[model samples]
Target: MVKIKANYVLAALWITLLCSCQKRSPEIPEIRQVDVLIVGGGASGTMAAIQAARMGSSVLVAEETPWLGGMLTAAGVSAIDGNYKLQSGLWEEFRKNLYNHYGGPEGVKTGWVSNVLFEPEVGDSILKYMAGLEDGIELMLNSTLGHIEKTQKGWIADIAYQTDTIRVETQVVIDGTELGDVAALVGIPYEIGMDSRHLSNEKIAPETANDIVQDLTYVAILKDYGKGTDMTITKPEGYDPSPFYCTCAGRCNQDSIGRKLWDCEHMMGYGRLPGDKYMINWPIFGNDFYLNVIEMAPHERKQAYEQAKWYTMCYVYYLQDALGFRHLGIADDVFPTADGLPFIPYHRESRRIDGIVRFDLNDLARPFAQTNALYRTGVAVGDYPVDHHHAAYPQSEALPDLHFYPVPSYALPLGTLIPKSVSNFIVAEKSISVTNLVNGTTRLQPVCLLIGQAAGALAALAVDEGVSPADVPVRKVQQALLDSKAYILPYLDVSPTSSSFSAIQKTGATGILRGEGKNIGWENQTLFYPDSLVSKSALQTGLQDIAAGLVITSKKETLTVNEALKVIYDLMKLRPGDTHFSSREAMDEKAKEIWKNHMDTLMDPEVSITRAMFSVLLGELIDPFSNWPVDHHGTYRSGIN
Candidate 1:
């Protein structure tokens, strides 16, 4: 972690206060600064701050809202992605907290893909606790970013309030703001609306592209316990139930953003409270704050946002009165302010980075074996489909079904997180480079948190290693990820000495580093799809299937340690740039040394012969891979050992 000057820190926080002092309020607190200035305390921004602080750096978060945890907390939505499997680290911790409160693990049973429904308050407490642990993480809420400029030493973030303006000159500036507003303010190249071309060749992209973008939503909390309460809520300014809808509230369309508008389907939804003993997520007010509010000027945006809040409050009144329910309240305890107005105004599109590598929809559906190039630099796996949400269908339409293209859990490149012009800055939110269609799926809360963790980890690596983020070696990045228990590279639990890997040699190879939809049968059999589940059965089956596929030249009396080493060396050799061995010559050298050492140990009977010993050695010797290989045409091509 780099040491920041005290004066520079004061400049960053005060810069915002300074900007605010000119207009409305008179008295405001002085500003404070830290090493890294995060503009948004949403999902990604929070994760970035925590990661940086964990690595021993000074970090500060400037949130426009009072509370953190953007969508999960402020939005009052209980559902996470349908594909939040392989839960670990920050995400896993979030679940643990919910389970602690709910008294049982939530969600329908689906092996690892089980959904974890939680109350908004629990989510808020958990996220705040996660970042609040570090003394170095300073939170400056109700502060707004006014501008960002690159100085010789590093970068400075200008934040403002009604009475004061603060400037934070830090080594790194992360644009975790939901709208990617910070990136725009910093002069970063970004795409605003839908992509001009169907880069992903997605079925949902319009035949004729336009500047139209997806609408936002303002989710409200509701409850019903058969108690007594007044709940007749007033509708929005233009809301009409008789002719309800312009856009599909419950569904999504892939193509034609210009044809979409907010509908009534999702205007108010119901779900089980933490215990599944009550009702929740009944959006009776604020038809859609995140959607229409983007078109407003700053003050107008604030007004629209507040109006949505009031509308949502009125909606709760409507639901209770209409349904004749007794037990229901606004749940204002969650947001603390805005009268239970969600802490976040669900932002869909933000300033996406124009990086060296771009992931389009076409690449996702391509045969994993054919487009293996996509995995060469994979840092994380995404088994979800290209989820796209558009406007224009009511609750009666099949709008949510258009986004059915399943993509593999492929590697995300380090390059994609780095901004082109801003060297120290990284865009961890949906702001990372991708087509709008791709952004639709990736913008989910879970994805943002995980990607933010990865980005934060990389930023930590850069700071710790005294190198630019671009120069952090790939292998170092992978190791740091592994150390943090993040799953950028999938791991197989096998034992040559134990029963886990009955046939050690065959079970240890990686045909596709991808999970779920890794271009199934396009080259090899790597099953992948949106509805894919990561079950214990799948893990066992994949291990056996790939092991059986290995070509054994000769059947000897028994598999020796020497022979196993050769096989291990060859499997890792499919790609030259990987960790174990980069070249055939190097592989042979390491194999010789390993074989000799094993032979020497075997020659001595005093050496341990227990299965436990063999298993430990096998696990240690197994090649750990972070990504797969692709051929020239960018196909998921693999060569057998």
Candidate 2:
């Protein structure tokens, strides 16, 4: 009996040991389910996270760096580029915040290069504050992408932190990375460096594809030396000081204009930040690393990154050593890095995805009348010139043909964000499907933010509808963007001086044009009477002119609420029994009968109407799905699409 008891104890101890060993081994990664997973925490990533969270989705944002704003903050390029006057949506919100933070709008306009400029830290704080407003968004800072696998249900990404890994399963994934890393990892086809002219059909594209890409820069934020401070930086390993003194902006560069070295401006520019500091992103005779990091291997990329930093350091050293700017040192308090440089290089080129629509220079050069469909299909708007940086590089004879000018403010289509072969995925940042020439403009901070917001909205809508993001209709996406107050159309520039400017502004939100009145019956008299009290027939005709499809006409003094409801009912084809009017449903009640009676009372043609009432009615007629009864829910504008 004793021996048997001992044997049982020994067996129990062995079992306990085996269990301990199993527990010590690695366990399955924690599976976290989310509606959207946004990779890259730059300008687009932050915007995407906020937009998706606002749309009632659980979003997980994994950023490789600690900062949220990529190019705007972490990359040290704080000077906002493009979309200065056409700001709306989150872009407008951010700019407003910046303006308020610095006392007013003039605070941000401290530099000549851009309309808005601030310290990188200011942008970082604002983005963090914005991210905090969304409870559904989980921002994972200092997290890197370990691995990713696509499943039929969605995508699974392994997010590795210090000593643990979290597996994120999301229905939609947005590749907002600066380099399109996620797209490449997921086997999506993309183009690196410059594309051939024959393929992109960009007038500026090269005849053959080349490995040469735009130069990458390590932007420097320098404070004025007159602030009673003295500093010095260590000289870079490569001490070559010859190329740093040349005139590269074509103003004095003899290679272009046959001028002496002293003819060009210095390789520096005014900073947009406070305290009159200077932002040194100068590509002329400065640190523009000519290597193509996107096409490089792991080892090669690291080498290039290190060399770029060294070049920037060399430039800084020259400022103090050669140029006699002893007080102008690196802003130690700005960047968190030990060397006072940005966490990442300013990558001007990335592996652009082969999206459903590849926007080129033609998209920017052509007028909206010639491409109305394309204009109406735009999801974002910008008017930046096609400014290419390769022109400043060595052996860049092709640069002359590559640069373009007078690029008008144009809209970017939803198709530009959708990958041709991939579902449940979208791209933001420079990785968007734009030709190498067009990328110069589309890659701007404001445009990338718009793209990010659009991608986020599409992802959230897809998750809500249980459909792929690519399946969501473009017009529906446009509607959501419009509701978000994004400026989607740039063609109808309404001047405040016009009597119909306010009406045009409102109606243009729905893609309507303020029509020009024509002479009727050969009387040579136009009926567009601005500042006159509008009649019922005139209002209806104006609606029709704006293409609202309302045909009811009357010469009555006042338009009744019933007439508006009837027009809406006719245009939307909403029967008496739709969910839109389900609020009237009760126990044993005829909801359709109630709706018909209610609409009849609301549609009485004799009720007097005001201009504000007309505007509200027009808003409802254009978008029947909107919750129209709420106070101030009506969109102000001419009804148009």
Candidate 3:
């Protein structure tokens, strides 16, 4: 009878296979091209779309997930751990929207860097709002890229989603995907393992080399009500067979009780919830996915997630099931994924481009003024210490909370983002050009956004100009970013000034332009440093200071006496123009003659400024043409992206 049943089972299996083979072909959607195509809709992709849209380019952002904001919203991780220099453009606008809607930073007087605590939904609302605020930005969610091919036109992205198969054409593409999938698809050369050596040379890395990277965390935000409920999760299948927790006393930094408190007992994470007391996205529970999370078969993927889920569920069960802890519950409902895990894996590494330029710790430690190309391309500012983390390393042990040299202002290179062969595609996550080990330094969210802003602005400009991203002039892009108020360069200009003064003096004082006097390094509490490059906005204040001083009596120029007299007469009669002489066309001929006369007539020999006398001389030189390109006062204006 058993043998007969086996024969029947084989017959049934063959019939199932036969039926599956008879399935019809799916109706694929027609392909469409775009000026700019972004692969992911995370923080970087969202910002890129904003840039392209503002530049008046038709752009499409494709995301596999349901929402936007990669680590910020999707991953349910809080706190933008990064340099303080993150505020401008889409980034600034994002913050403003958050502040306006949530009243977080908007209520504060100064919000250069406010640690605004909020739920993931807020981030979701804000990103969606930004995408809507701009035109020409199409966000295609649930879209998956099947394959990418480069043709004579540019590149073609073959995508499949839900019940449709479509193709997208674009001049430029951005690989904002979390895993660097676009780079891999486009054949970008990149490194995967940790550097056998330190970031630069053999300075600080471990002697031996390894390929396995740092651990990933599945984060979620849970609230408590101070009263126990049925919010506990049960142990997953194959829980006991898992070897993914910190086991060694040395590694875990726990004797026995600590381990029991977290592992065996699990009574640690419960906080005053319901009352909204604490937010949990801690490192208390770590899953062992590297050892067990692989998908050899379609069904295995579910098994993998189940294991991870069990790890998390068992974590809470240790609190509720084993410890009978009160007021403790899992917030898994807040971020449930298709596999019932957190929306994101908190990945530490994906794909790093091996393109034009590669950044290493050596670049940071490369002794300033000792490098080129890389040093010249700084678009943002950062001073955070190099931070790296891995699971195999004893993360549970009492760490020194190590910190390395503080990098002031350094340029993040273009090569790091662009793939070697793909001209249009760029990356702006922790998965840029770096050995997996170096990702430790670049993974910080703020740094990621800094990279994102630059990539976004560049892609936007490329879309607007109908050119390859490689062809866009970096300087013009820099200027546009500067105009948008994004922090693209070093923060060397921050002082008082006004449009009524020449930007030359204000900027010269701050530092960018070379000056006659030495860089006295501003120890004098009374004197404004002449070498410092003051912000363009400050020029207005500087002009006001100058206008207030009595030095306005002006016996200025030591030019040809007759020329000076003519200049004085012209100045007395010429109050009717911008830039001192109509900067518009039709008046170009007149402007040219006036410019020549002005240059020849007023060659002031000596320019002087006191904390007091400084203002008057500045004003006299400014108000003449303060509304020009550099502003009437000439102080360099700046904003952040």
TM-score of 2: 0.75
Arrange candidates, best lDDT first. 2, 1, 3
Arranged by TM-score, best first: 2, 1, 3
Encode model 3's per-residue lDDT on 129-187: one tens digit a residue.
66766668776766688878887767888766556666788888888877676777677
Worst window of 10 by summed lDDT in candidate 2: 627-636
Output the better candidate (2/3) by lDDT. Answer: 2
- Which of candidates 2 and 3 is the stronger one according to TM-score? 2
TM-score on alpha carbons, each prediction:
0.70, 0.75, 0.67
lDDT of 3 at 33: 72
Instruction: Estimate the TM-score for candidate 1.
Output: 0.70
Q: Every model's Cα RMSD, please? A: 9.8, 13.0, 13.5
* lDDT (Cα, tens digit) per residue for candidate 2, span 1-641: 33433443354344224322312112667678999999998989899899889989999888877778899989988998776766567898898878767777887887767879988877787787777767798777777788898899889999875455778999999998989988888877888777788987766677788766788888887776674566658777868877676524433445664333432224344554786566778665777777677855656887778878888888878767776666788886788787788888888878888987777777556623233334445677766666677744678864545443546567777778878888889888889887888887788889888888988888888999888887776656766776787755543233233333333334433333222222222111112233233355555544442235557654455555555455545544433333333232221133223334434443334555444344444453334323211111112222222
lDDT against the true structure, each candidate: 0.54, 0.67, 0.51
Among these predictions, the greatest TM-score belongs to 2
Cα-based lDDT at residue 416, candidate 3 = 69
- lDDT per residue as tens, model 1, 206-259: 555545555565666554334455433444465333222222343334154334
Model 3, position 403, has a per-residue lDDT of 32
